[model samples]
Target: MKKTCLNINATHGGFSLIEIMISAFILALGLLGLAGMQSTAVKSTIEIQQRSLANSLITDITERMQLNRLWLSGAGNSYSIDSLTDANLSIPNCIGSGGVFVNCSGEDIKNNDLYEWKQKFTGAEVNASTNGENGLVEADACIAVSPASGSDGELVQIVISWFSTVKSKDAAANAGATDLTNTCGTANAHRRQLSVETYISKSS
Candidate 1:
């Protein structure tokens, strides 16, 4: 009898359960890292928008002050204000019944400017009732005019302060937050502010 060679087929190699689990874990880690990155991007974008809004607000108030230089220069640095929500602020009627422009005294124009500026922050200008809808969180503004040091005119300081949803990177900043930072609002880790200063003279 001739001996016939018997052949056995080798088993195919495939991923084991351990290998599959490891691959899944690595994939999950990568997905989690991607999600974290997206969240940080959103937060940073919001912070940047808020910063831009703050700058715009400060610039607006500064321009208004410059327009009233005749009044501000003669006021002896008395054109100052704090807390945009101050109930004492009186809104003046600068528009006539026919939606016509009316000439107003410098004082009336100043009051109107303040009221309109507050409306911008209060969302009323945007047709929304929410406060701080101008990309600010619990925002308030201050206009402080004082004698300019080594200058021939009054120094006008316009500051816009807001609550920041983002936490501060410096622990000491959060701890040391105060009204001193913005001259209007007390801040914690979430405090942010923008300010501009210019010298105004009556002669100019």
Candidate 2:
């Protein structure tokens, strides 16, 4: 009997170098996409936070105006001889109050609050100085009590404004500064408005 030699070999199933490299590249691409998405989300979250702060600031002022209706009306009447300026109205003690500030007296509206509000916000500036032309110069509320003639009501006008971190032409020019509306226009610009009107419901 002649003996025959038999040889047997097994092929191992494994990924080739090229396949491994390609898979790594694909994974890298996916990771990069995820990173980009995360970055975008962070930016959006920051923007929302800024806007929320601004809204809160505005709301606080509105409430003050409503609560201190007497102060507003009194100031309007007393300052009738003079005009409302940008400095006349301001957010009070932004830093001291941790964002809560109020002024019972009209004098406090001038600089006390503005000074504090500026310190609270990382990058914010206020320019309120009542000393020029009248007709809602730069005040959040220009309570212009209408002539009673014979009525017992008064008209109050309120105008409010706030600085925006984004949306501004000058902001585009200056990377450091930002505008809220990113557009230029009295109506479109991000601004704090003043609402003024008269009410006969109460007497001063």
Q: Which candidate leads the pack in lDDT?
A: 1
- For model 2, the local distance difference test gives 0.42
Best by TM-score: 1
Q: Across residues 1-204, which tens digit of lDDT does each residue of candidate 2 receive?
A: 999998989889999999999999999999999999998788666556655654554454344434434544552432221222233445544324465444335545534433343333323233234333322222231223354566543443323343333454432233223232222213323343322233432244
Quote the lDDT for 165 in model 1. 66
Positional deviation of residue 82's Cα in model 1 after best superposition, in angstroms: 1.8
Q: Which residue pairs clash within candidate 1?
A: none
Identify the runs in model 1 with alpha carbons over 4 angstroms from their true place: 76-78, 87-90, 97-99, 127-132, 149-152, 169-183
Against the true structure, candidate 2 reaches a TM-score of 0.48
Could you tell me the lDDT of residue 6 within candidate 2?
88
Task: Assess every candidate by TM-score.
Answer: 0.83, 0.48
Candidate 1 accuracy as TM-score = 0.83
